[model samples]
Target: MKIAIYTLGCKVNQYETQAMEQELSRRGHEIVSFSGAADAYVVNTCSVTAVSDQKSRQMLSRARREHPGAVVAVCGCYPQTRPEDVRKLDVDLIAGTGDRMGFLDLLEQELEDRRPMEAVDRVFDRRAFEILPAGGLEGRTRAMLKVEDGCVNFCSYCIIPYARGPVRSLPPEEAAARAKELAAAGYQEMVLTGIEISSWGGDLKTGQSLIDLMELLSDAAPGLRLRLGSLEPRTIDGDFCRRAAKLPNLCPQFHLSMQSGCDETLKRMNRKYDTARYFRSVALLKEYFDRPAVTTDMIVGFPGETEEEFAQSLDFIRRCGFARMHIFPYSIRPGTPAAELAQIPAAVKESRAARAAAVADEMRKEYLEGCVGQVYPVLFEQAKGDRFSGHAPNYTEVLVPGSENLHNRVLATRITGTEGFSLLGELEETP
Candidate 1:
């Protein structure tokens, strides 16, 4: 059988999709592009926002419509939260947010029997972390290890808590074992991803935390560059940063989740930390690491967010001076508490996003300029004509003009200039 998988949303979803692809390939099934012909189509969906939900639906619909004879499977947050909505789309197989192996079983069963299958369980009832294969398919430069799953922090604007369930962490030994395997598999980098990685050990009753997991993986896979996924602001402190800073292979890029920077806005969003606390996390990362890339995500024009609050957020973000930022116009997710509040007008939301983006772009340019003339060991991933591109330890994209196949090779490159958002570099030994 030939399977086509289309992934949407966060790195966790991508990791799960890759696990599915790997499993299917091992079962002697051919893995093909989602756009091309295939025996089945898997749509790994995301429901982080209204737009994400719409995209999930569109992709599922397209899979069914385009490949009418092929089996269509839908999984991930979309079906986990809104199974009925997914059922309405008439996909052949439906599995939600758990049991990757079982989901594959359902996919195979559907193909064999031509019977529809639905495997969505109540997400909140899930307690165990589903362990799937960690690495991607052949030739991938980087692999993500999902060391945690689910979220406990029920932010007013988030449906993920309901879609994903409570915090369930992959045991440290399992995660370390997988990290070692990835390193042995020739992956130069391994990303630790989850729904909320900072909340990793909450359910385990063990005193170990994310920093412990990082240290374990750092030791287990000493050769692999370990990077983290989006982290909670509360996760960073003197202890966390101090320990993380000592891990020589840990990438300096820290993507702390900051939906809104204003205290009142954060309060309404039910965020655990305020602007003051979040800033401390940023400050600690910068203080502990050398020019560490402090990145964040901001939601502009959240429900009931006033112009003053938006401006405050803008000002606060500027104060943080993030290396890179993902700015979003808040969209009402129907099941979330924020959806019941007074919604911001779409135009206003978009306008605020544009304004925030302008500020973020300026900060990005400043950060890129700071990278010039520095030497960084870049893990080159791909080549395009005379150029090979990869990323520095801070996750900054660095491109070097080279005819050699630098793919999967870490080379110390000297940054010569900035190319817009990316850095232009030359091999340190190049003439």
Candidate 2:
């Protein structure tokens, strides 16, 4: 069977799509492109926000339009959460966030029977992490080993907890094995990705934590660089900071999730942490890692979020001095609690988003300027012209003008200056 996958949203979704691709290949199936004719087209959907749902629908529709005769299989967060909406679409197979292997089987059945199949079940009944293949088979420098699944946070604005169910973790031993497999495949970097990585060991029950798993994986792949996915602010503590910083190969870039910076807004959103706590996490990252890239996300114009609250959020984020930021204007999702709360005006949301973006841009520029004259072991992934570009240990994009194509090679590059948002420099001889 020839399969083509179209994936949207988080790194976890991308990881899942790759895992499915691996499974198909193992069963003697060919992976093709969605734009080309194929036996089946898999739409790995996302439902993080309202926009994500729309994009998922658009992609599903496009797949059907492109290959009307091909089997259209839809899975992931969107179909998992809104199966009725997906049922209205021209799809042959429907499965939810869980059971990738089962979803593949259903797709195979549909291929043979020439009939539609829906294998989705209640997401909350899900238990145990469905471990799948790690590393990229498509020749990528970085591969994500999803160590965690599901979210229990139940933040008022989030529907993911309901869509994904309770927390499930991959055992430390298994995670280590997966990391070693990825490293053996010549991958230079591995991202510890998941739905909510900070909550990794919450469901494990054993006397282990995310730090313990990190220690094991780092030990397993001593030569491979390790990067982390988005983490909850409450996850960062003195112990986590000290232990994680000790790993030499672990990248110092930390993306602490900060939906809203104001304490009042956080309370309304039912977030687990406050602005003070969030700032402490930021301070800890700054203290432990030598100039680590501390990035964050912010939602503007949340339901009932006053102008004063938005200002407070902006002020708080500016004080944190994030290296980069994702600024989003809050949008109402039908099933979320925030959707039923007092709504903010769309124009107001747009205005606040723009203001937050400006502040974020300044912080980004300041952080990049700080990188000037610093030498970093940059894993150059690709090149355009004579410049080989890659990310620094802190996730700073560094472009070095070199004659050689430094693909997959970690080169010592000194940051000469900034070129727009990226650092421009030349390759330096090894000391």
Candidate 3:
């Protein structure tokens, strides 16, 4: 069987797609490009916003229309949250947020029987964490280990909590074992990713937290560079910063999720923390790490967001000095609380996003300028022409002129200058 997966949404989705690809390949299936025809086409969808849903729908429709004979399977958040919406489409199999292996089983069975099947279970009823393989089918530079699944933070703008259910965490021992396996497999770096990583230990009866899990993973894979996924502001404090600072292999970049900076806007969004607490998290990271790259995501022109509120958000983000930012205009997601509220006009949302993006660009330039004259151990991933590109511990892309294929090599690189968003660097000779 030939299978091609089209994935949407977050890093977790990407990891799951890769795991599915590996499993399918292991079971005597050929992985092909989504553009070309195949025996099975898996459209892993996302419903983060209404726009994401449209894309998912379009892809599914295209898959069915182009390859009339191929099996089209739809999975992920879009169908998980709205199975009724997906049932209206021309899909053969529908699986939700959980159970990838079972989903594949159904796919194989469908191929033989030619029956339409739906395997989306009650996501909230799930208790055990579905452990998938950590690394990708092809590369060794970086791999993602999903240590946790689900989110209980029912933010007004988010549909993930309902889509992914409550917190279900991978045990510390299991996570450590996976990290060790990735290290043994010659992976240069391991990314600990999830829907909400900060809520990792909530479901487990053990009195532990994300920092504790980080310590365990660091110990298990002492040679692998461990990177973290997006974290909640409440996860960072004095103790966490201090403990995390001591982990030599842990990357110094932190992506704290901050949707809006205005307190009123945060209240409307039902965020866990206010601006004061979020800023404290930023300050703590800056205090403990040496020029740590702090990145974040922000949504502009949220429902009922006044111009003053937007101004406050811009000012607050400027103060935080984020290394980079992902800015998006507010998009109404049906079934979420915010969708029923008075919506902002599309023009207003787009204009506010542009304003926020300008500020973010300035901050990014400032961060890149600060990187000049610093030395960092960069993990090279890819090469183009005479330059090899890699990322520093702070997650900053560093490009150096080199003839050698530095793929998967961590070399000492000294920043010489800034080239747009990336830093231009020269490789240091090892003695």
Top-lDDT candidate index: 3
Tell me how far the alpha carbon of residue 117 in candidate 2 is from the true structure, in angstroms, after superposition. Answer: 0.5
Write candidate 1's Cα lDDT for 1-431 as tens digits. 98999999988888888888888888999999999999999999999888999999999889888989999999999999888788888688988988999989888899999898889887778888888999988899999999898888889989999888888999998998999899999999999998899988878998989999899999999999999999999999999988998999999999999999899999999989899999999999889999999999999888889999988998999999999999888888989899999889999999999999999999999999999989999999988778999999999999988688888999899999998899999898642
Candidate 2 colliding pairs: none
* lDDT score of residue 21 within candidate 3: 92
lDDT of 3 at 95: 89
Instruction: Put the candidates in lDDT order, highest first.
Output: 3, 1, 2
* Top-TM-score candidate index: 3
Superposed model 3: Cα runs more than 4 Å off: none
The local lDDT score (0 to 100) that residue 70 gets in candidate 1 is 95
**Local distance difference test, each candidate:** 0.91, 0.90, 0.94
Enumerate residue pairs that collide in model 1.
Answer: none
Q: What does the lDDT read for residue 302 in candidate 2?
A: 91
lDDT: which is higher, 1 or 2? 1
Listed per candidate, the RMSD to the true structure in angstroms reads 1.3, 1.3, 1.0
Q: Model 3: per-residue lDDT, tens digit, 1-431?
A: 98999999899999999999999999999999999979999999898988999999999999999999999999899999989999999999998888999999999998999899998889889899998988886765999999899998899999999899989999999999999989999998999999999999989989999999999999999999999999999999999999999999999999999999999999999999999999999999999999999999999999999999999999999999999999999888899899999999999999999999999999999999999999999999998678999999999999999678888999999999998899999989651
Name the lDDT of candidate 3.
Answer: 0.94
